[model samples]
Target: MSSISAHGLGGADDLPISGSLAIVGGTAALAISFVVLLLAWRQPRFGRAGHELAVPPPIARVLDGSWFRAGLRVMGIAFLAFMLWPALLGRNDLANPLLGVTYAWLWVGLVPLSLLFGPALRAMSPVRTLAELLDKGTGRSGGEGVVPYPAALGYWPAAIGLLTFVWLELISPSSTDVGVVRLWFAFYLAAMLLGWAVFGTTWIGRADPFEVYSTLVGRLSLWSRSASGRLVLVSPLRNLSRLRPEPGLVAVVAVLLGSTAYDSWSSSATWIRYVQSNEVDVTRLGTALMVVIILVVGTTFAVASMTTAVDTRRSARKELPRRLAHSLVPIIVGYMIAHYLTFLVEYGQQTLIQMSDPVGSGANLFGTADMEVNYWLSQNPTVLASIKVLAIVVGHVLGVMAAHDRAISLLPRRHHVVGQLALLAAMVGYTFMGLYLLFGS
Candidate 1:
């Protein structure tokens, strides 16, 4: 029950498994994914057709009502107010709810919320709501930017923003400090508002890191608004095709996968011992390691996706990564769940308890401050380890399916089997790397 081990809650000390077990797990992860190449639907089912389930008329009315949206926005702002208060004026101590709220709840908690509800952050974004309010207050005309957002920039800003946010989470010594959180949010809010002003609202869509991330994961959510303005319930695979191809899309995914990988790496004893023994400043070294990991992940995928040795359209080599970028979402989200599930469940409770005493006045405004977090999951490493492995395998399977769909659509027919080699290798490497981090390190 110590924060000394992991990022979000008490450390994760996984029950050690034998080398043979790890090797078997890694091979199974690859075998399961590679199975997609043999039996994958060749016609691109997801890209062409989505299996939608009808919503009953009465239920649809409630879900699509204007009041529901407004209520969510109001709730988002209220939570924003709660966290902002502690960040600004509350005690700059662990008793302050800011640490738990930011790390445990907001970042890690966004995964499940998005998976179940779809773009939960955007629906409840205080910044998005505030931006809307600011624009309306000024009575804008058409809301076009003075300078149209460049087509070339795409989500690269979001990619950079993601890296910056994760940098704060991963490397900074003052990460949990109230002043640090305040300053970080201060810069974030100011930049968001100012960017919206000059570039119009497209700036926020392109540059808003958290929103982009939430929306990315939202693709896996069962509930989504279809083209005809109806809320449709669909399978996650059916919903996967909805991700629009955009510039920097691949890079954005690369950052997500690589950063999550490094976050796990940092918790390993290998990383811990190296940082402690090194003469170089730990912060700088940590930053380097993060950057390196991100680059390595991006490079691996890019090479694998582009290196297919087939006679095909000239642009296929260039566009392959972007075309298949959606495959990484499942993997990133899966790893996120694997890495932070215990942290979120345990520390999320801790956050709720802390929120009741936001000002550190010892007053339990919600009358639930006396709650004790269940640490049983943390103690039962065997069950936890099984869940983590299963999650990684599931993610790999999903990634393979997504990639297979894209490959059939994009690659030439003759190259389909042979062409998937690089991609399959990449998925196997990525999956095994995750397992290795979980088991070996």
Candidate 2:
């Protein structure tokens, strides 16, 4: 099988702004935001601030109706079948829709979907639907299994699952091969099903990577559930602050941020030349480097979160990282948009076209076989670069605010401003590195 080409609009030379300017601007934005937040925003104002607006009864009724939910579940299953036709029997070349669907639509497209809608995958997971059906057939409760889920497990399983997916996506030799992609999903489905049988629907929320990812990103969305289980619109910051700190939350965010960074780095000329010059196996080396990058990201954030002076009696230093992990969601979403915007726009269209002929029979079943992918984003490199920079800066600012609120709430009154200095520095470093990778790569 031919290697899949890296996706991007253009090289660093093609960017309108100089790399130095972008990095400096991004760093300045982060520093300024930190200072403004430190001085102007002294009190903790999220999580329990009650900024939510109840949805109208008519809209809420439709949204929470059983029929609507069932339709979504059916749609999810039908879409799964549509993609499986190509993965299981279509041509083994790039023409296959499987590769594009997996990489472009499902992976990259999920971010925006989650941001617009709340935990889209959790609402329409085919695996969860199937589990529920099986449980009903067995005369058992929908989310109940043979045993209760252990609280100690937390999000560790989801973190490991996410790491495995990134490894397959970024380092596997046959990542785009039809058979390999099919096999990977097969194992994923089997594991999810088996886990559901053992631990019930709770397993899906805690172990399914895509669901966990969507849930994390969905915190930024306006849609949220109220205390009475009704859907309501709330401030994104408040919704984000409601994320409960759990074990391995830091690791999950680390894998997301680190893998994206490695994706940018691996596409750079430096990494490509290094791989070509050495006699080492590219897969093994890439895998090791990816793991190291993830570890470094997690370690840096963990150390930074714990570096501040805190009253040990009030807040445990070791738990600070997980508590602050919600801030990284915005950063991850920002980098994802920067890295995958063109890819999603271009390849996503291409995938739609290919889906019209899933079996390679030259059938335009969906009348999209002849559609051409528009390269508008790629054609305008400067505009694309500007959007990327803006996204990074805005995300950095939001993250700064989130961190500041959490830090102040966790620390003593006197240490509020001082306790955030280390975290602020770490966030600045992240922004600088993100800009560097964006422009340099």
Clashing pairs in 1: none
lDDT of 1 by residue, 39-86 (tens): 756677786654788678899998778998899999998888767677
Q: After superposition, how far is residue 374 of candidate 1 from its true place, in Å?
A: 0.8
Model 2: colliding residue pairs: none
How well does each candidate superpose onto the true structure, as a TM-score?
Answer: 0.94, 0.97
Clashes of each: 0, 0
Model 2 compared with the native: what TM-score?
Answer: 0.97
| lDDT, residue 140, model 2 | 82
lDDT of each: 0.80, 0.87
Give per-residue CA lDDT, model 2, range 287-327, as digits (tens): 88999989988998988899774756435788889999999
lDDT score of residue 196 within candidate 2 = 86
